[model samples]
Target: MSIAGVLILPQVIQRGDPGEVVHFFGIPIVLASYTSSVIPMIVVVWVQGHVERWLKRTLAASIENFTTPFLILLILPSATLMTIGPVTMAFSAGISGGVEWIFEASPWVAGAVMGGLWQVFVMFGLHWGLIPIMINDVATLGYSVMKAPVVASVIAQGAAALAVFFRLRRDHKIKQAALPSGIASLLAGITEPAVYGVNLPLKRPFIIACLSGAVGGAVTASGGSAADNLANPSLLSISAYLNHGNFVVFCLGVLISFLLAFFGTLFFGIPRSAREEEQPQELSEDLDSGIPAQPVPADKKVVDADAQVVPAGVVVPVAVDEGNTTDLVAAASGHAVPLSEIEDPVFSSGAMGQGLGIRPATGADGSSDAESPTGAHPGRIVAPISGKLTAAMNSGHAYGVRADTGVEVLVHVGIDTVQLDGREFTPHVTKGDTVTAGQVLVDVDLPTVTEAGYDPTVITIITNSDHFSTIEPRTGIDLAAGDLTVVVER
Candidate 1:
């Protein structure tokens, strides 16, 4: 109805001069065009969703399906035309014009701020506010200068990823993921891979990329580079700039963005842990691969000369009950499972060390017996080893214990349970507290965790498993608090 020749609505006809008019029952109509506008549509859809929800809740069940549609179809469209359309259009246009004015008046500040905060805008959905303006600029002016800065932002993300790849030494998995996301960002205009996987996870790299993007955006805008057509910003789409924009300056902008981000990340972005070399990867994989290394018979001498960290310890009877060997007890009773079954890659991939997962057992009333009145909350997690409580979150979801033997253990209660804000957790100890084996750390309420849509599995991880000679986990069985479960031989 808004476009010159699309759907011909009733009573909405082309009158004299000032365009189309809706002459309905002598009512004064505001003929606001909804032609390729984004804000008005977004506002309309949002209002529709809220109205539908309210109607669904207020209507009687017998008449809900039929009567709800009747009311929506009857009342919403007319109300929208009279209310939301004009207001949203004016609001959107004002903001768009104001931003354009600011940018035109101060190109350097505009370029720097827009380039640096583009990723932040995407994160919080503020980027949607600019979509209509960019589209309108293309539709009305045949080009858009606003998008030049954004293209540099994408280039910076890829550059940061590539820098992380080159800087990383220990984790081959991160390197493999980093290289691909970087390439994808440089070739195509996809930033999700680099943004989520590489740069954002490695905090400093993201900041460096943003700063580099700001520099590049300033150069691109000030040097008079613009896009002739609205194309996805990438190296493959650079041809679009060749027609009318300064293609040479555009190349220079991207090159500067890439070099700055790449070098900045290489110099200051990588963390010390990522660069530190670790034990062979295969040793950790053997724990969860379901193919155990051939165990030597009780009497035969087991040889582990080729093992990277320490000798594989699966000897018999006496268990060599001596030196450097540390025993880890179960934090709570549950059905034990292998770490490979866990959803979080940090623990599942053994990146945080050898992990053991235990699904909490539920009692009669959907809650764990740990919450029972007996005061003997068996579901409560205890310190696995007598060590200093090094890390205890205020949220009471996880705890870290560092033993004198140099073994570090992290006791995590449930996956993503932190979102509950300690709703089902009770912390018994704080950070820097010296705890004994079997001492209660955090009492868990399994039912609340389950009801809140999180996995209530307690996990115990050996943080520095590579430093030890062998880490042996006993899974696929029932566990009890204080029961010896993991054996780490140094």
Candidate 2:
């Protein structure tokens, strides 16, 4: 049908007049115009499938074969041309006309709106509404303008994923997932994985991709590009626009969409915290490798009065010290407040251990003292004691350090900040790294954290308070990094 429509049907239509009749074997056969039509052939084929099945079931074998061929060749085609074809064509025409009217009224606005909202529709599974309309437009008018801008939405999503892949080169786990998803979207136009799995989780990159898609959609609409076939927008489907004069403009719009989304996400979308959280799980998997296999000699082992000696069967060595007080310093430059004053119950009730919450000090420039010179918030988190980091969340929101004095401290950045998945924190060191007092542990963007609706109070807790005779927290005092905030006696 496609070949006949494109090659032979036009000439036949030009040679004949409407309502013309032809004869076969002295029998009159009225020719209802079907040249270059889309629905008639499809309806006939659809009807034939059902009709053949019925004929085979009801008729005997020898009779069924002969009757089925006659019924399909003569009756089905006539019924399709008389009923189904004309009705479907009219319906398709109405849809095409309505869409054309909208495009004609304001091409640029229509393009931008559609391009921006296409992904939103996809996210909610509402884009299915446009699929049939796009198909009808191609069937009735030989092209569809609606899909041209939608193509930008697909391309932009892929670009956002590619941007993250490039930005998070050190994050092996994230790179492993993102690289394949991005390539699939770019070459094959599959975008749901990139959108749902990668871009949406990061927030900013998804918005940037939408904005870039809007730009491409507007450009394509302004240049009057339309897809000539009902096919997905991809490099492989470029041939669908070959005969259309707007092919070059279509290609250019796609390129602009890709470049804009890729660069926009790379520069401003993904945060340091998100990138830092992409560390491979392998670091935490080899637990045995980090443990000491043998115990130290009795002469070298100094047990603290508070230390309990478990049988030597435990995999990891426990630190010990004589009865002495260890001062735990503040992790951030801020004024300390008692944990009871904090808004969250987990900290206020001392459920996450005994701690003091600090409200970060604001600088003269209206930025928090914890903010970096580059204007990123929660400037830095420093080690409060010279210790080995026993556990650190890849999200950079929390760290557990065990001092040689047998004091275990947990530096937690904020209340419920874990839900942000490390969008505003950057870790300077991973778990198992030896850190000294005042050494940078993580850099945080407090403004972004607050903007995400999380409290930016830094909490310093004596996690293993049971190992100490007394854990005293100092509150209502202005303190800097390394200043004594908690006193632990063992």
lDDT of 2 by residue, 209-265 (tens): 999999989877777888888777876777776675477887888889999999999
Estimate the TM-score for candidate 2.
0.44
- How far is each candidate from the true structure, as Cα RMSD in Å? 14.4, 23.4
lDDT over C-alpha atoms for residue 441 of model 1: 93
Off by over 4 Å in 1: 1-18, 136-142, 224-230, 242-247, 271-490
lDDT, residue 254, candidate 1: 83
The whole-model lDDT of each prediction reads 0.79, 0.77
Which portions of model 2 show Cα errors greater than 4 Å?
1-85, 169-172, 277-490
- Count of clashing residue pairs in every prediction: 1, 5
Instruction: List pairs with backbone clashes in candidate 1.
Output: 310-469
Task: TM-score each candidate.
Answer: 0.56, 0.44
Q: Could you give candidate 1's per-residue lDDT for residues 1-490 as a string of tens digits?
A: 2222221233322331144455557776656555545666667778878898999999999999999878877776776666676687678677667766766787667777777888889889998877677876665456667788888899999999999999988768778899999999999989889999989988999999999999988877765566767788888988876755567877888889999999999989898888777766555545657666777788988657675354465434345656778889888777778999998887898888896987767553544423323233545888999999999998999999999989999999888888888887889899999999888998777766776788878899999888988898889877677777898898
Instruction: Give the Å shift of residue 279 in candidate 2.
Output: 9.7
